[model samples]
Target chain A: MPVNHSRQKRGIAISPKNNSPVSLFFEGAKDTFPLIVGAIPFGIIFGTLAATAGLSFGATMGMSLFVFAGASQFVCVSLVTAGVAWPMIVLTTFVVNLRHMLYGATMVFFYKNLNPLWKMVLAFGLTDETFAVAVSRYSKNDGVPGKHYYNLGSMVFMYGNWNLCTFIGLTAGKAFPGISQWGLDFAMPATFIGIVIPYLVSKPMWASVITAGTVSILAGGLPHKLGLMMAALAGVAAGVICEKVFSEKKERI
Target chain B: MFETGIQLYEIYMVAGMALVTFGIRYIMFPLSGRLRFPELFERGLRYVPPVVLTAIIVPSVLMPTGETLNLKLNNPYLIGAITACAVGGLFKNLLLTIVVSMAVFLGAQWAFAMGW
Candidate 1:
């Protein structure tokens, strides 16, 4: 009960009995609102840039609706603008989105008992913001049932906001042609810092952040955004190694 | 004829992007209930978010233009990101951190443009 009390202070639900799926859904949306604010500029910039890059309205909207991944959509549009072939565009998309596989792997444990259809729906919305929010929720020891509604809530809210922001950007882009160049995309990195800084509580986590950050900057020139993947792998490996070393030291002590 | 060809090209490209994106995201779903990872692998999974997010945040903050490192004081991105880190660390409030950071970034941009 004390543990639940502390979690409740942190805004997690106290127990399953007090939370209905509908309330959980709303709570999820409310929690995700901050990250959604962070993403608004990103989605709008994508739309403005895609239009500037000469993508048809249909194509731009279709990519947002279908692909639904922010970073990959940006990469795809840039590649298209550069006259890259479709196959290469797709390849870049694949590479840009490979990090989602790691996200999916981390989430699979929580969702292993979920229905396949539910898993499918959630997977479509497993973006950086949604995953960040949902993983924090899932990791809490609050014994809440139907928490997937929370995930669904975050996903639907983000999905709708992204598309709507894209529409606004497309419409406003022609009117204010310089909107995309305003460097408003800084919101994303700012949001990421907020999300990540709270998690740097352990030696392994610090190792992971340092390794990944260094490797990414060092390999920033890699083609097709491969630097991201390299940095991620190096970071994870460093964390795992540090975790092992630290735990072994603790055992000896 | 030319119009139709362009439309077709766009369609093909969008479809290709959709397929690859969805495939990567959904690959682990079908295997979720069926597969179990090793203990070490499971422990390693905990680091994925911090690592991936940091990998993204670092380069984007340090190299906003993606062409060069901008560690100068005039770089709004670097200034704003550092402020965000400090605010987040102290307040641990997401919305407040974002708002304050954006304000700082905008102010920095204006000052730098004025030759400050």
Candidate 2:
């Protein structure tokens, strides 16, 4: 598969086109730094909770490495501590992560031009943070060269930071047992606000946000974060319906 | 207060969760290549970012533990989040939003702890 090298030589110096792979990678890292800061406490809290839940260091780290979804990992640890059956734990986590399907599908538009190998790698690294950064970048200019390198950069930094914090929490969790209670989790919601608020320039977009936010709270009592899945589905359905209705209204007028 | 052991069943659980999580993340990319989406479906995918993100953010802020359901003035997360959203809208800076939100969160927590 020939890379989209033709998109290069447009000679736009402001875009990723003029940058080297190494420079693009670092640029991605730099762009993602603020989000990573928000993730720091969440990662450490996972470590602390895992340790407090009596999970062995290897098991805790293994969960972080293998599952790699923050909310699901937290749910898995809680369920494991609660003595829930392993199958139930697995099933619940699976349901919680179903949102990744949307992330993957949405990302596929920009990624369609890349080879399968690049797709596979980016797929692994497609967490919410990376998706937010990369999607915004692609939305701005889909033709930027080495954009995949930028994605790789964000992924590597987040991956390392998560694992490192888990280690820190596993070891230092005992020393600072109250760390998780320090209200740091707010950073994540705040980051999402920054990411999503800027993009609500249309009715369908605003409808999606209103629908998803309302449904998420109403469904919060659902087990294993099923509320998240329900809210996401509802929001997408609302957005599509709103888009259709609005377009039809415009056409008729 | 908690039992400490690496039981065989726990290992199985870890592997099972990992496989399923990875499967969900991995399955979509290939399927998108193989299958064709309808025109509306493609358009709907554009809203995925806002919708999914709002879903994640709302519950975390409003009901931090999925149980608290805090909406009062003393709920530092909610107050700080409102402030953060305003700052984010006004400034359009992630670092500033986080910094302001965290500062508001910590400050609110301290203020409430002091009974005012």
Candidate 3:
């Protein structure tokens, strides 16, 4: 059967000796720690800003625990403060998070062999930070046995960091009202730069990054983060076209 | 105990945001795993992380307030991002990049405040 063929191919590729789930999990956690450092200020800013925006402690923390996405949470808080209606808030958050769909698509190739429960758990835990690290690992090893545990480690650690920081910010934000403006937020873009720079090894890749970043800045004023979604699509399209053209030229030569 | 008129409604909004956020995250894996994407489409997905991430990161720096592009010398964020990108490209170390970037950002902000 096609399922068996797929399973056998992936199963054979796994380095069984390297299947140390616990160590892999901790390694994932360790690797993700630096990213967590960046996220601390992000979560704190969200909590503090949400409180000042008139959200109750319970509501602010609830959003962090439940929504878990940083950008959307910030957007939700601002829109809520502006007295935007609930549907609009929901729609805006959803649009802002559509990039996750692309992440899921990229990961599904490696995740397909997993059982439903594992799929559900990892899917729930997936974030931009975890996905960036996890996808790199999966891309490196098509069949690293117990690879999902690494992603689990990253996700669980990030989830914990986000929640704890939110609590700290909510309770202590008044004492340090200027904490958000302390420029700790620089960690995020820096973290992202570190993540993206490693992938810039090809013409199509460089083209995609430059185009996406430029489009995002130019379209920054778009309503509800549609610019981000638009830039992602444009970048992907540009990458695909560039890949085809460049490959054809190389072949002709 | 300030009484905001929307306190009661915030709960529902929070729930709605949670549902939509989780729903988006949960929607794709199962379907994509079972289906077959065309060769070109599959190849393109490999570029998704860098492209989408840069798309998110760039605006956060250049347009921190989301209203205007601040390419000015006083913009610590732009300076910090450039510093971080250079460090990341040169060293490929996440922690050092963050640490140095924040240091530079704080230093630049301080200098700007001092009218330098």
Q: Which candidate is the best by TM-score?
A: 1
Would you estimate the TM-scores of all the predictions?
0.93, 0.92, 0.91
Model 3 lDDT tens row, A154-216: 999999999998888788887888887776777778788878988999999999889999999
**Local accuracy by lDDT, each model:** 0.88, 0.84, 0.85
**Model 2 ranges off by over 4 Å:** A1-17, B1-6
lDDT of 2 by residue, B1-116 (tens): 22356678869988998888778877877787679989988887888888888988887888766687888787888998899889988988889998888899889988998998
CA deviation > 4 Å runs, candidate 3: A1-18, B1-7
TM-score of chain B for predicted candidate 2: 0.85
Ranking by DockQ: 2, 3, 1
DockQ of each: 0.60, 0.68, 0.63
Candidate 2 residue pairs in backbone clash: none
Candidate 1 local lDDT, residue A82: 88
**Whose lDDT is higher: candidate 1's or candidate 3's?**
1
In angstroms, the error of model 2 at A219 is 1.9
RMSD, one per candidate, in order = 3.4, 3.8, 4.8
Off by over 4 Å in 1: A1-18, B1-6, B33-35
Task: List the candidates ranked by TM-score, beginning with the highest.
Answer: 1, 2, 3
Recovery fraction of native interface contacts for candidate 2: 0.77
lDDT (Cα, tens digit) per residue for candidate 1, span A1-253: 9998887776644444447888889889999999999999988888888888888888888888998999999888788878998888888889999999999998888897788899989999999999999999999996777889999999999999999989887778677788877889899998899899888899899998999999999999998789999999999899999998999999999
